[model samples]
Target: MQLITAHVMSKHLSLSSFSFRAPQDSPEKAIPSRKLPFQTFLSFNPKKPLSLKTHLPIMQISKTLFVFCLISCLSMTSSQEQGATAYEMLEKFNFPRGILPQGVRSYVLNTDGSFEVYLDGECKFGVEGGYSLSYGRKITGKVSFGSLRNLKGVSVKVLFVWMGITEVSTGNGELDFYVGPLSASFPLSNFLDCPQCGCGFNCKDIVSDS
Candidate 1:
């Protein structure tokens, strides 16, 4: 009975040792679970709401800049159109008159911007006008002229007129008119009207015969 008991006790101790060693030597038991990084966890957290307050100001500034650029472009286009129109009118009317007629005259621009022209002592035309420069400078005036008269019987009269400006420069500021015999081959400056010149005589001979 004692021998049987000793054999059973030794067998029980051996099985206990084997169970302890099996866990320490196993590859699956040695492997550890991978843990996620803190940064990665924050980025993927679906329950957290992201605040975009810092970006709002930048977006607003960009929008403001876009609007400013658009306004500047529109202003430039309008100024160019006005300048073109003014230049066209000058070329069509003023430049062709190489010399002003004896009776054709321009009124001196005044502080109150009013002036008059007379033809044969008669009131003819007048104008009241105002102008501004691109830089916001202002010029205002009115001009009136009388009937234009010559020995040739051609006469013209002007009515009241006014002009406004956005800007002024030396190159853009003159008014001119022409008057002479239409049939004469020579420029009117080459001949002078005589004291007795009348509508019945040739303009060329009237000056020489006098």
Candidate 2:
């Protein structure tokens, strides 16, 4: 009787253990599994294929490119306008007797449309005339008028001449001067020489000995 009872108890325990294990292998009881959230987010959804998340990088690149292009275009336009202003000033003055010496070359137009001339890496002069002739460095100068009649359009012309002088080549020892129209001319003497006696004749009236 004891042996029979022990056999029956062992059979009952084995049956219980098998029943618990069987459910674990069933599809319904298994742990739920699917793609990760991040991976799913990256994939183009068939229902909403044009989602912002899916196209985020492309949008970012497009925005960046647009900003870059806009900046580049604005910079180019600004530069062109500055150049045009300088040219108009030059035309207005019409340096008829090209004042800059042969070796002097133009550099660039300043913001104020003044011409700058350089000789041996040094500033030579800045010319501006309103009702009179004003000549000196962009920082300092004196003004004189041959006649008020000559002063017509004088301001614009003088500004252009100053701009032209400022643009002259500094590497070369040559000095460039502007006369009346856009005619660029080179004088026969050094820039520092007396205007009364040297190429300064064009610049003499405005230039002072002191």
Candidate 3:
């Protein structure tokens, strides 16, 4: 009876102390950690600077593509328009080249008859009508057969106040420039040659045909 009780007590102690542990090479031990490098994608770390090599895939390239297309279209259009000089184009529309001043830096003419003219800077001069004319660096308008309408960036001085030139008409050997309700007519021969800035057509530096 004494031996039986001792053996039972030893068995109870052994059961309580025993713990089941898997082998060192078990499948659970071979699995990787949950906190991996790739899991924290595009995450900023105060101690580490950004690296494009790892985060390039997440960038938005749509805006860059759109801007590139827009610029390419404009360049192609500008190149196509350059086939003809601005003055020559004016002649083709039945308007004299002299209507525009000298030193045109560039111009863009659209298929719909809308055009933009660019100059180095503002140009101001006096015409025979005793009126002072000023031309802005950028001029925009629509040109049609024998007429320039919707004119902007061209102005005239009347009674110490500057008034914009709204329209121009050419026909019957006469040229008319409109300043509000008033219009001035000049002979077509006056515009045979473009006038130079600060020196009407009577430029002293120019040599005569003789």
Among these predicted structures, which one has the highest lDDT? 3
Lowest summed-lDDT stretch of 10 residues in model 2?
140-149
Q: Over the full model, what C-alpha lDDT does candidate 3 score relative to the true structure?
A: 0.73
Model 3 Cα lDDT, one tens digit per residue, 1-210: 011111113433333333334456665543232232441433534235634344343333545556667765654444225588778888888878878888888997765677899988888887886778888999999888898999999998887999999999999999899988999889888887877777756674445632
Best TM-score goes to which candidate? 3
Better of 2 and 3 by lDDT: 3
TM-scores for every candidate against the unseen true structure: 0.21, 0.25, 0.60
RMSD of each: 31.1, 24.3, 21.3
Question: Higher-lDDT candidate among 1 and 2?
Answer: 2
Ranking by TM-score: 3, 2, 1
Ranking by lDDT: 3, 2, 1
Q: Which regions of candidate 2 are displaced past 4 Å? A: 1-52, 78-86, 89-167, 170-185, 188-210
Count of backbone collisions within predicted model 2 = 32
lDDT of 2: 0.33
Per-residue alpha-carbon lDDT of candidate 1 for residues 55-132, written as tens digits (9 for 90 to 100): 555567778777777765544332123444322322333232221222322222222223232223212121112211
Better of 2 and 3 by TM-score: 3
